[model samples]
Target: MNSPGTVHDWVFDAIGTRWTVTTPSPLSRPVLDEVRAEIDRIDLAWSRFRDDSTVAEMARAAGRYPIEESDQPLVDWYRRLYSLTRGAVSPLVGQTLADAGYDADYSLRPAPQVSGVPAWDEVIAGHDGTLELREAALLDVGAAGKGFAADRVAEIVARVTDDFVVDAGGDMVVSPRTRPLRVALEHPMDPTKAIGVVTLDGGAICASASNRRVWADWHHIVDPRTASPVREVLATWVIAPSAMEADGLATALFFTPAAFLRGDFDHHAQGFHHVTIRRNGSVEHTAIPGLELFL
Candidate 1:
């Protein structure tokens, strides 16, 4: 539903999710066209649900695959996430997810004998402009792809207006003009309730929750080490300079501790801030400038 409110909000569907773009004024036709093209490019390169996507091609063949320069940054970020999470988050887990019934068809029926994910070093090697897959392996980039697309759209919007908000699903990038944007953090167990609120001056915020996608006894967040769903964390939210980083960190917090990530990113000028809710109902959050929790 595209509506023109006081802020000029446009909502649409893309990449298997909804998106909303808000600007000081209406977006130009050229900007919208470019945004759509960029989204299509991202979906073609990273979507595992499509048969003709680049990831699907890698799943069918094992060899050196060339990729666009624009795609290289995401590959690098995935490598960083893999190392930071100690292999808990891996692109090679696509087959494991499919075997557990989260395949392209969304079968939701686990295979009788699910296979373990191959080691990162064993399955693939990264090089400039290309990746060498040792064997056929399905790669899933859903973790950060949506956020990257959001950032890309924000870049397009910035070309026209300096102040805008690009929201791809729940991953958002904000460029405020004067005051900060107030964001409600939705409760993991109940969408109608808000657990907290954030005052985002600028940059990006992303969230991940186990309760968002579930079927039977399983959820979308699977532990690659055991080839099963993770039950430790209920939800996580991250605020960073980039939506891609925020999105990846939101998932990484599920597999790793916040302290480790905090220590690593502390060197930055405005380091990332995060909020975590464990399955035991305990909440952990950093004392940052923009976060406020009801509990």
Candidate 2:
């Protein structure tokens, strides 16, 4: 795993997630500490796991008062995700999660009796960054948190070095120098096998599969449209200009129609060069148009 003096790798837990950072230059310990702090800050601002997180605070404050502008980024992010996915991906899925047995924390407790969540459109945004919900809604950004954190960490690392990669679970943001970054897609049913490999010149790559992070026979990804699990595809990988886009799109593609994905998915595939793996271990991948020059 060593890449001479041009690469350094570090791993730690933050934002209720484990993150791995690989960069060109050997960053100072203090710099890595600061990056970890930034990851924590992003999580506290958006995590559903933390009671004091901005999302939880808004959930608690819903109907009592208007949510402040401090949570604007999350609001905007959700709005975009909802719009892009045709409402397949939603922050309002918190209620569905609770109904299915998820509680305030990840202790795997029984689901408490709860009411149904209202429509995603019920969450209204003010001119400023304020948010107003017609009813109390549980907001969860588990779909986007890791990719967002990886993007932020990559930005911080970019300041110190020109080449790097940040992987939060399977989501990654790479800044390559000497060689194209190569990533293998682990089989959902069998981790010992890889469906295929993808080489990235630079940018972000994120994969969402039904097999990862399950609870009580239920997968983490819930279709906001039906408030049920996405069953069409076993796994999807997306590569985009930014980590947030790649992360959110991967989640969205899991529930999107195969027809709707033909052009759009191929666009990103050609743009950033992505590889996808299905449950049956089929490989769907495309190389960037001119990336062979860089490789």
Candidate 3:
């Protein structure tokens, strides 16, 4: 259901992705300004592109000492991602990326060098908010940044209205609305066609597609176990109670084996739902028992 007043739409760029916020009610100009300011604050703190960002500063300060406790979210996210990927996704992949010709920055005059795959265990986080690395390690948060941004913006929007959605790239956080929110999953190989639509109610939805970051047949979603691109799953969607979970799970599912994509996955994740699109274009969905499917 729509709100009683006019629907307002706002768009801005943050965390290297486009962010959109939609509300069903006519918000006062001052309120809208405050919301935008909050979004900017989040980007400044969390953006990996900014050299002064908390993540970048922490990465630079690695091996020197642990950062402050206020930087706990970055540490917490690293721990969660490590557990979720079984150490398959780590900030330690900085060396792998450097060897793949992405050193320093992904711009003109980039450095090219061969470096060994850094191990996750070498990168340690202390309870006092300090991060240490046994060896030189490069941390990349490309996989989780959008989700983090979505989650942050969602919290801000929730303060103003009950019905709102924050879409950062393909990850989204949707609050309770008058009706179910419909989300369309794009085909991995063909952006024009949607493979399916999922009806979301007061949860977050995130989709990861394999074709977006391909380079010479190699993609960004690397399998840390093999230090290679994940080839089996073309796309994965995860629905969870929060955008950060959904975002991390979607990336982790790309590295999950096809056998695990079957019914048994639900046993591991209690309330989460999954949709996997195979390389052959076939779709498989598994959710908790009795869950409805819009596709």
Candidate 4:
């Protein structure tokens, strides 16, 4: 459902998830189709499930390989995130996750216990667009790819209309012209009930939860150091200038505490705001002057 000032919403499927675009007015079918294609491009490049994707190819190589210039943005972002989190959220955790039977199939069946995960330092990234992997590790971009795609979709939407909300699954880039968009944070433990409702005007919002993609004791987001599922925080919401940053920050908050996030994520200049809901149903949030969290 749209909030006050929106005209209608367009819903479809992409990137292995549903995508909806809420706008003040309906967009042309051609523009909508273009948006779909753009999102699909991101999936084709980063999806680990696909046999031909760049990420899958990198995983298969397990050795020194040159990355495409087009993929440099993703590599740079990951490197920054790795440094910021102090390896709490590493791209190398993908191998550990796959070894633990959390492969693209999504069977969620428990696999043999993983011993340890590789470090981001081991995978040498060069400024010349080359990535040399010292050992084998799957590079998972699931953390920020969808949100990045959402931003790209929003960019496309902005071309036609100034007011729109591009939601790629739970990662959203909302640009509201008339009024604020009402966004509800679903209970991480119980999806049926919402924990809070917040207003999003002209920024991106992404939520990371341990329960959304869980089966057994394992979930989608895995800590690189421990090679285990995150448990302390049930969910985290991040609002940032771009959906890509917001999405990665949401996952990073799972592994790293919120207090340390400001400095690590350059929250000052970027105007980053976060809300964390722990396993005990407690909340910790940065005090944004006008934003209200209705719990």
lDDT of 2 by residue, 96-139 (tens): 78667665655554355434445665664441445666655677
Q: State the lDDT of candidate 1 residue by residue for 1-295, as single tens digits.
A: 4444457888999998899998867898888899999999999988999999989999999999887888788888898999999998888889988888889999999898888988899988764689899888899987788888898899889989887899888899999646888998989999999999998889999999999878878888888899998999999999998999999999999999987776678525435788999989899887656688887
On lDDT, the stronger of 1 and 3 is 1
Full candidate order by TM-score, most accurate first: 1, 4, 2, 3
Ranking by lDDT: 1, 4, 2, 3
Query: Please, what is the TM-score per model?
Result: 0.95, 0.83, 0.81, 0.89
Better of 3 and 4 by TM-score: 4
Flag clash pairs in model 4: none
lDDT score, candidate 4, position 179: 62
Q: List the residue pairs that clash in candidate 1.
A: none
Model 4, 1-295: lDDT tens digits are 5466557879988778888888767788899788877767777777887788777877776565666665567678888888878888777777677766678887677777774776666665452577776655567888887887888888888999877788888898988545677788877777888877777767888998888777777888888788888788888999887898999989999877777777655646634888998888688887643455656
Pairs of residues at least 3 apart in sequence or in different chains that clash in candidate 3: 1-179, 66-130, 66-131, 67-130
Total clashes for model 1: 0
Model 3 regions lying over 4 Å from their true place: 1-5, 26-48, 54-61, 64-74, 102-104, 107-114, 125-128, 257-270, 288-295
* Model 3, global lDDT: 0.68
